[model samples]
Target: MTTHEPVQMLSARLALPLVRELRGLGHDPAPILKELGLHEAGLRPLEARMALASWLRLHAASIELSSDPAAPARAAARIQPDAFPIPLHLLGSQATVREGWRFSAPYLGVGIDGLRAELIPEETRSRFDFQVQGAPLGPAPLAEFFMVGLFAYGKRVIPSELLPDRVNFAHPRPAHADALCKFIPCTLRFGSRSVGFEFPTAWLDLPIRGADPQLGQLLAEQAAAWLSTHEPTPRLADRVRLWLARNLRDSDAVASRLARDMKLSERTLRRKLSEEGTSIRELVAKARQARASELLGSTSAPLDAIAFELGFSSVGAFCRAFKRWTGCSPARYRAEL
Candidate 1:
């Protein structure tokens, strides 16, 4: 399996939910950890992060062991204010949903549970979609946690009224469903294809409460320290590539710039990339090529402007690069998309 880095040390916000659930079950969490291939030693630390796989396994085990209808709700109640929520808290504290979304995204391990999230931009709006490819152990807590967190998070970023299209629970909500409605304002649908949130594209620019440059700097410093010691994720390259692609409009999308933000020297950054069998230039090109295709297909951004954003010196250079990458002109690519 292509292992991605385990999530950075989980925030107290995220782990607190699971801890509370285990406490409520009157069951020690160690056994659950054992069943899920995690060590009991991990629980000794307050800030330790584990594999997303272990989390899902324990979650599934909890549902099966508890077999109680109120399990998910009870677990969710552990998420009170002043919790870490892992990277989410850091992300949430950002100045805008866009910043938070981008920052928090790299740490989420949805694929560990056979799920993947996509941020799609439609003509009129953008949506965060969670697509599932496997059976959820109960999926109730996962859904509840995500829904409630998103609502609470929205309050810090966008207005609360703009909830998701619906909470796409694969199964129906529990008997206590009415109380769930109080958390978010959007329609709640059961048995949908996946769980996702749809918001007005304009909200992407909405400022967040924690968008301070100083705060961002602090977080960047702390996060870099945390990531450096953790096991490297194979998907890190893909992640870096995607982030760069999405933020291509930003001038500081280069490796050295990102390395600085990540609190690493350019030499160290290249070494890490080398360890992963990839390089900064390769990732940049990969990201630019993917983004160019998307922009060509989705927006009317001028070709020259797009080229410049991708760090090309001229339109002809971008065309040459694009042809080398995909054997097609930007115009043709847009037409195809």
Candidate 2:
């Protein structure tokens, strides 16, 4: 049986608390959920998963309706440990904060997709970085929520003064920055390369409150079993395609960067792609073509802007490639549409 990795998805239960919190704050979440093609009933099941796009849309809509910039953070604050999905339980069971984060980082994808957590040990501090993949960052709300929610979860399990010294956000600072600080209680840095926080390295050894080695072992086994059943081993080619599509806008979609991101040597990456019946160049071309079609069909963006967005050297270069792919010029293609 051919198995594929989990696409951009998160457990539907991840959104339920936010929905409840929204309703509590006098915003009717039902209409928003319906508009997003989500039913509250569907999100109740532990096994139910929703597209990461849908999750971002839901958060964006909630913030818009409430007219509150810190709505996501507030909702996250209200989420108790028990309210979280199974994957989070795996984190809480580990012996120490560092072990919990490191051990549970791999399984977090089972509960929340499109987010990667890396625990980096620095000289005096440990940095927990959150990288958003497979989706747009979506107006800074989810990024805010994840950072704040991490601290909140840490406090529950670590039983100490568990505040990060600094927090970083990839998005620009919002007008209601103070509102976020009220929840995060840290020196917040905006316009960062990534989203995460820095805390005293000594905290890594802080014991998790009420941790049980036996329980941790059981949860680890369960998490592993759940992962194997739900998320199949991913194909290398699919991962390469995703990386190319996400990074193409930044003009960082080169083969070397891709191989490095995949943790493979360039020659090994090439050989693996050959085994998968594809090439990085072919995938990049297809990604550009697909993005071009979407832009042409959906928006009235200028060809030069589209070219730049697709990381082409110039409009002429893009035009040549488009014609080669579609057997027609971009102008003619748009006119025909």
Candidate 3:
């Protein structure tokens, strides 16, 4: 995503499990990593922000590799947010799903710009809408992931088993619908307007098992501090990419211009970037890919305009380059978001 979009990170909290799950099913994960251009090292850092492109490709590869239509739901149903509690501790501190949902803003926003999680509370019932950001992806896997993940997570923290009164999905039911009963034991409805859970409002106030008022206050303060200082002092390559993103609208987005902006000779810039295992051209492309994903994922910007904004001469040119970078055309990429 662009610097302007919500900050996104790939907590092994979700990513590693998909890879491990695939392995558990007797599939190799090496090809999945290679297809997505990710290293085993990238998954090691729990707090590291993954490339959105890689994240998307990883999901696609997992589903394809495992040949499991229900991979997404099972992956989410099994993820334990409490294991990586930098932000989840924020949710665990709350007394109710309603309050927990509200406190989850920072965590969800930072982690999930590709999907939207909303809680609509009424006098008698509440709606938790987990809508995909763009058009439907796959069997609309994330829809199952989020809806089941939330309930599974709640069941972990609350003293009693917490089940949604019912569920709704934007996608039509797949052949594997029967398996959903094992994941979510609730009234399930498919072909709805959105994917989410519906429950009585009374449960919103149900006490979480280990909530502490003092700890809540402490974690809140810590989250605030972490957010403020989280963006680290940029390394040489990161600074170069930032400069490229900011200047992509201008035609002066080449390495000479980047070198000048960094107050270095082109040769020195090249050497420095080589040390970082990237080139100016590679950095520029990375920036453009990220900005492109941000524009498509969050806005209804025209393709030609986004192309121009990324310094492409025309929509055709942008489409070609984006496909090379991501293996999908701009429209296809946007549609699958």
Worst 10 residues of 3 by lDDT: 130-139
RMSD of 2: 12.0
Reference-based lDDT, residue 24, model 2: 84
Rank the candidate models, highest TM-score first: 2, 3, 1
Candidate 2 colliding pairs = none
lDDT of 1: 0.60
lDDT scores for all predictions? 0.60, 0.76, 0.68
The window of 10 residues in a row where model 2 has the poorest summed lDDT is: 130-139
Better candidate by TM-score, 1 or 2: 2
- Pairwise lDDT winner, candidates 1 and 2: 2
Model 1: per-residue Cα lDDT over 13-96, one tens digit each? 354466567777787776666665665555434255565555656666666778854455455544554444445555666677
What is candidate 2's lDDT per residue for 57-124, written digit by digit as tens?
78877678788867877888777664576666777777887777777777776776545565656557
At residue 227, what lDDT does model 3 achieve? 56
Residue lDDT tens for model 3, 119-218:
6555676766653332222235555665666667777788887677778876888787878867998888777545667777888788777876577777
